[model samples]
Target chain A: MIRVLEQIGRVFLRLFEETGLWFTMLWRTMAWSVRPPYGVGEWFRQMVRLGVDSIPVVFLTAMFTGMVLALQTFIGFQRVHAESFVGSVVALAMLRELSPVLVGLMVTGRVGSSMAAEIGTMRVTEQIDALEALATDPIQYLFVPRVIAGIVMLPFLVVLGDALGIGGGYLVAVRLMHANPVQYEINTYQFLDMNDVWSGLIKASAFGLILTLTGCVRGYYTTGGAEGVGRSTTAAVVNASLIILLSDFFLTKLLF
Target chain B: MTVATNMEPQSDPNAEPMISLQHIYKSFEGKEVLRDLSIDIARGESVVIVGGSGTGKSVTLKHIIGLLRPDSGHVMIEGRDITEMRPVELNRFRQHFGMAFQEGALFDSMSVFENIAFPLRRHTKMTEEAIAARVEECLEQVHLHGVDGKRPSELSGGMRRRVGFARAISLKPEILLFDEPTTGLDPVISDVVADLIVEMDRTLNTTTVTITHDMKVAFKIADRVAMLFQGHIVEDGTPAEFQRSENPIVQQFIEGRAEGPLTDGTNE
Candidate 1:
């Protein structure tokens, strides 16, 4: 029992040390990212890779979510003689919460994990060291581009997710639910204000920052080669998703 | 005081050293890897650091390039201290050197041309045409002219090594550091890499510090050889001097003996 306790204490110490090292590296990377010699081209390429390439998945997920939300909202409001408010509720919910959170989760699974694996591989292979030897700052050349691209492009994806989701609600409510199309459209536009869209965009921006920072931080500290890269990738996605979800709640409370 | 210090025999007045280390000490987890190690390589000289595994050979190279800091020492390049340089200053200092990593480290996402052209595109304001021309020249130097369009995974180990060499020399650095240039290669390929190292030094007049355990490759190209053992240089001399050295560590390593100090596991 004493040995077990001692082992646990050792593991805690190791975690503390690793966290300190990771924070130091992240600070260095963030400090260097804003300086000159920007890889503008790489940033654009990453924007296309992260944002444009992820549209299909975001659209599919949002459409289904919107359809199901409309169905559930209509059923719940029917007993209250307020089924007319179903379209408004579904649209507002999808725009303010579902779109940002869903897109954030999707990107965490796709781009965040890949970034960790790629950077981890580079670290283990000494490519990052090679860049340093050649006088090329890896943070400026690599991390800044991806981070800026993520921040710039994620808002657009969230907007797209919002639009597709609302359209899916429109499809289900008008064609299937036999609702008055004019009333449904009017209710959506009236209830969903600019604040709803802005709030979703805010969430998207925060999620993007959290996702990229966590991914790059995990990857930058990865060691030991293939196994290490694999572990970092998994850790990046899980940690990024958790942070985004936790922060989303805090930000929503503060902003709303 | 200054004049007296300059007059000391420890300072070479005639030939300025291209790279120098002074009282370099580095330790990891309380285990010393380098213990007050100091050495100098003259301009345009090729010095090979010969040591068995874990003799701080690679650590020494990393220190020279400022990848790792000495616990308490100074690393001087072209007579300037780089031990405590800031990021921008370090990058500027590093621009003067190029390193070929042991694994060749080709970016899988990029084609060979892109990988070779990476440094040029990153550092220089060169036009695409000029970058292309430079990439072609580098590829030609490594006898990899037509393979630029291929991905790294499509290439063989030797081809990848050559590509790595091409990328290393792309920026026209004055000093080159090679970490195990001939490691994990067939004998023929090792000979090819060794010849390329020699040819590049002759053509570019570049100062080179190569760390290797392959004595055959080392003897082929090193103008001077330094044998590191137990965190210190046990022998420093010409290849011939090293071959004839009576130092048991150097003799045991060069002869590849399991009975020697390297495999005894007593040093740790």
Candidate 2:
């Protein structure tokens, strides 16, 4: 019993330690974000790297997800003679939850992992130390641009993802499933209040903060060597994915 | 426990040392790496610290640059204690230093020219034309030329170290710190690097401190050589005095012998 208790205590200690580290990183990034020499050039470059480059994959994922969701809901509603409601269901789900969560996960996998690996390699190779020795703040030079890009870009990506996803549902519903085109279009927008779209965008912004902060924090504290970079990359993807999922629930509760 | 008598450098008594480390004690994960270590380097002097691997040489350099803080000590630069400064103040304080790492640590994402140009772009308001000329001048100072368009990955180890040197000197810093500058170079290249250091020290006339275990490199570039053993300075003097010292550990290290107080069980 004593051994089990000790193990449990260790787990909680690690959790608290990690939480504090992430919060500290977030605080510093914010503090540096407002400082002079805004590094606007790097910020735009990262926006293209983290946001624009992610468009194709995010669109693909959202389209497929919406089609599958439409098909499943259509078939189930048909059993109850409520197949007409399929458009509403698909549109509501995509706008309120699916688009933000899926895009967050996708960006986490694509950009977050790369950020961790890049910074982690710099850490091990002593490049970061060289930066400090040159009288440059690693936080201002490195973290601010990436974090700002993430926070500003994830919502825009989700907005595009939402459009593609709904369009994909339309493709399946009208072309393949033979749902009434006019009725389906009307139902899609009828049930989606302005709140539904706002809530998802807000969640996307939160997810943006979470994924980028996690990547930077993991990369900054990385030790060991090449193996440590690999570990940070894997942890960045896994932890960002897990946090997006966990935060989605809380965000949904608060937003709704 | 054998401390050399010539632990102090032969400098003028009235002038302040350019850099001073006082009672520095540092450890990692409870393993003590530096214990009550202290050293004073005069302005415009070139000092080399010689120590074996894992002897906290890098840690000592890091402390001087504010990269790592000592557990209980003071790192003073130009009579100002840096240990109490905040992060922003420390960064401003560090503008006076130019540190070159063992592996060059050049940013792989940039070309050689950009690597050398980074500090000037960040710290100064030099226009593009002026920055380009300065980069060329710095590269020339390190005896490197026309490799600006290439990446660091495309350069040899010796060339990479030179590029790192060019970058370090770009800002014309007041103090220079070199961490094992010749660790992974051939003897010929190491000698060339040593020559470069001597030339830079003479031409720039800046205070410089280098940490290396290579006695040859130490003798070639250092005005004074200090030997670190068991987390403290065991011997410090001119190269001639250091070679003729009676300390068994310093003798063993200088001679590269395998059997002595350093390798024997007695020191532990």
Best by TM-score: 2
Model 2 accuracy (lDDT, Cα): 0.91
Off by over 4 Å in 2: B1-13, B266-268
Q: Model 1 over residues B149-218: C-alpha lDDT tens digits?
A: 9999999888888899889899999998899998999999999999999998898889999999999999
* TM-scores for every predicted model: 0.93, 0.97
lDDT of 1 at A191: 73
- List residue ranges in candidate 1 displaced over 4 A: A1-30, B1-9, B266-268
Best by DockQ: 2
Error of 2 at A105 (Å): 0.4
For every candidate, how close is chain A to the native chain A in TM-score? 0.91, 0.99
**Candidate 2 accuracy as TM-score:** 0.97
Q: What is the DockQ of each candidate?
A: 0.75, 0.91
